[model samples]
Target: MAREGVTMPATNQHNEQASATPNPFPEPALEYGENPARFLVEELSVDDGEGTSGELMLARIRGLETIELCGFWLAVERALANKESREPRERVERAIRERKAELEEHGEGLAQTEMTPADRRAVAAERDAESVAVLVDEGGEEVSWSRQSGAAVGASR
Candidate 1:
């Protein structure tokens, strides 16, 4: 089944085998019902003592509607945890800041304006959909962390 852009296997045939298989990377300390498998994976190049090498890492998530906010939070966590160098770490930090700004801008529209609970929910949903559209248009396949101004992007509450 597809939830947002994430695809879950149609059948449970692999459930038993998947449970038996060990995860190649360390399991993230996330809450229950937060499926780490739905997180976007990226191969990042890291500088080792000898030379630069690539490692599998979690990138900023693109889809998964239910956990969009949580996924972005986890992406920031993963980005911080994985980077040791100043330059790379700063880049990740800047990206996260931009994403947060986007969310805040979108949220600001809802502030000061009073509406009924149902109206509030509808407006919130509209803002979320717009945010996703912005992300998709700006980042294409992956949410770009590069600095940009104006439009709100990424996930918010």
Candidate 2:
């Protein structure tokens, strides 16, 4: 089900490969027998508690291509810079700078990491075995994700 006020560009994975026109956001290369590529582009409508609204597009990409990932990060940085609020914009900018520094130092090892066919199979099996549930605090201001057990396993901000 699609969310209200958010639109996704229509794309067929199979057709994407054959098209002469390159996709603005293309999927990263995958290993043999690896799972299909999937990414998310979220447009958030933020209400300032007053009538005014601001919007931002956040992209979550998973791929092996470092250059394409950097390009996507640039897009996200540009979007965050254009946001109306100063707080979130500054926070995200700082985070991006910190992350870039960290990546610059350790990215060589990351670039070398690759998933084997067996590793992909194990990941798929693990995903299939796990059951996930979202839990909300009493005031509904905080949320967490729990596995099969009701106890909170990970918190989401």
Candidate 3:
């Protein structure tokens, strides 16, 4: 029986229709090995909104589809009784998570930006002066300093 205004609901397999037309979404490009999975964010229970049932306060949630307790699945009454005394714990956890993420993200960039001692010295020398002196042992192991400034042979003469 169908209502006048409301149409019939979809089938259990929503995508399967009688007609064999082209599917808008083909098979996924990447191969998913056996036992596929989904990514989900779990938010702790707050205010009056609770877990599976309104009465069951969620301690933690595992996955998107299969949401349950963080570690243990507690009965609604037990969970409500064992609720957090205060919400400061969540804030500390949030700060640690943010800092960890920032470090992980910037660690590589920091490594890349760092220069070796030799490289740093070369850069500093380039910035400091246009010429440098090369000390040579010319006179029977006697050290002699000579400035290398691209100076001309005429000046030497």
Candidate 4:
């Protein structure tokens, strides 16, 4: 069933390759898959809180690669956040600065009012997982992932 403000196309966004550690979120439209080649996920709608915006979706439009550009920029941001070393962090930050300039000049053309389906799901899952991890760690339990079930299990060190 589709939500009130979201519309997704029917696409198999799941990764077929089985790994030693499986992904906890396996729904195709819910998370980023292991395969980079599988790009098209689903269409989404965008709406303002005041009901003043139009619907926009992930589509291969003519002469418009805004979705791809947005995804690349997001990946760069993620890499910057995940990098711990100063050198790598500095490199990503530099790239981000350069991209920010370009975005400032052309952002209006590529502005998205709603999150992509995969991104929305990933964000929610990440937040939930982070909260759970923090709670577990606070309880003095070493949080570990189970390879067989792909669930986070509390263990004693």
Candidate 5:
């Protein structure tokens, strides 16, 4: 969902071909199937003092118009920190630059307040998964995903 500025060739996976077999009815139907997992949130949310902010974020994200935009929001949010105007300029600049390419890709002036039903489910899963009681902290490191542990087994390279 790159919004406005950066340009890159995107994978056009949304395209689907018509069924090879012909139907006697003459009309055709659209085929649709893609695992919703790609839209899933990747990391845990940082617990800022007020637990309410995260809940709000999730709620707002669920309201976003498309799954594609929701995925982009997750990226931009992760790249940002500190709402304080007093924070260092470099930090804000970095955050903006980190997402500039994406901002460009999403096609101009997009709003962040909506989501598709599929987007809603993906965000809901992320929120539900956040409630899990135990997690091994790899300390800002990468870890291997384990179906058994449902945790990062070790630092990701």
Candidate 6:
């Protein structure tokens, strides 16, 4: 089943294949229990072929956390859709909302990002000003909007 000119590499003691050439993109060392579950962005750049540079970013998530988050979100969706799961769904939703409210109160916002609060606000304001379809509630607070859903989020500090 081996293809012509395609030879399998010899495995080392760790079961990893021994390569003749060193890998440019070596694996990053990560500790699971040391850090909380989160997303990390590693930004790179490439030429756009028009004298402009384009961003190449990596949104890195650890293996276990990825699976756990996917499972949790799926369960939440299923529970919300099923009438029989109303009680459990409500409790879960309430917890999430409360946590979100607490985070907002503490000015943590949601998730970790590299951008400072001021920078984020500036970007949000720029986007809102550029877009004619920006959604604003009756309170008219300046908040960041979701890129995908165009929904207004928590007010900026």
Best by TM-score: 1
User: Which residue pairs of candidate 3 clash?
Assistant: none
Query: 60-145 in candidate 6: lDDT tens per residue?
Result: 21122233333343343344345343443343344344554544443443334787556666776897777454455556644345
Error of 4 at 3 (Å): 15
Estimated TM-score for each candidate: 0.29, 0.26, 0.16, 0.21, 0.20, 0.22
Tens-digit lDDT track of model 3 for 96-115: 34444543444311222477
**Candidate 1: stretches off by over 4 Å:** 1-41, 45-88, 108-120, 123-157
In every candidate, how many clashes are there?
0, 0, 0, 0, 20, 0
lDDT of each: 0.40, 0.39, 0.29, 0.36, 0.37, 0.36
Better of 3 and 5 by lDDT: 5
Candidate 2 local lDDT, 62-148, one digit each (tens): 222233344455554454444533333443444445555545555511333486545656776897776564455554443534323
Lowest-lDDT window of 10 residues in candidate 5?
23-32
Model 3: number of clashes?
0
The TM-score-based order of candidates, best leading, equals 1, 2, 6, 4, 5, 3
Which of candidates 2 and 6 reaches a greater lDDT? 2
Any idea what lDDT model 1 has? Answer: 0.40
lDDT by residue for model 1 (1-157), tens: 2234332332123676445422222233232223343232222456566532322222332122233454454564465455533233444345445555554444422223576545767877897655333333344433443534433455532
lDDT by residue (1-157, candidate 4, tens digit) is 2333332222333344323222222342233223211221211234547532212211322113334444543453344344423232343334445555544555423344576545655776787666343213444554444432333445422
Q: Residue 69 in model 1: shift from native, Å?
A: 3.0
What tens digits encode model 5's per-residue C-alpha lDDT throughout 1-157?
2334432221223333222222211111111122112222122366677444344434443344444444444444343323222332343234344444444455323334686445656777798666343334446343333433445444222
Cα lDDT for residue 36, candidate 4: 19
Off by over 4 Å in 5: 1-53, 81-157
Of the pair 1 and 4, which is ahead by TM-score?
1
Lowest lDDT sum, 10 consecutive residues, model 1, at 55-64
| Candidate topping lDDT | 1
TM-score of 5: 0.20
Query: Which candidate, 1 or 5, has the higher lDDT?
Result: 1
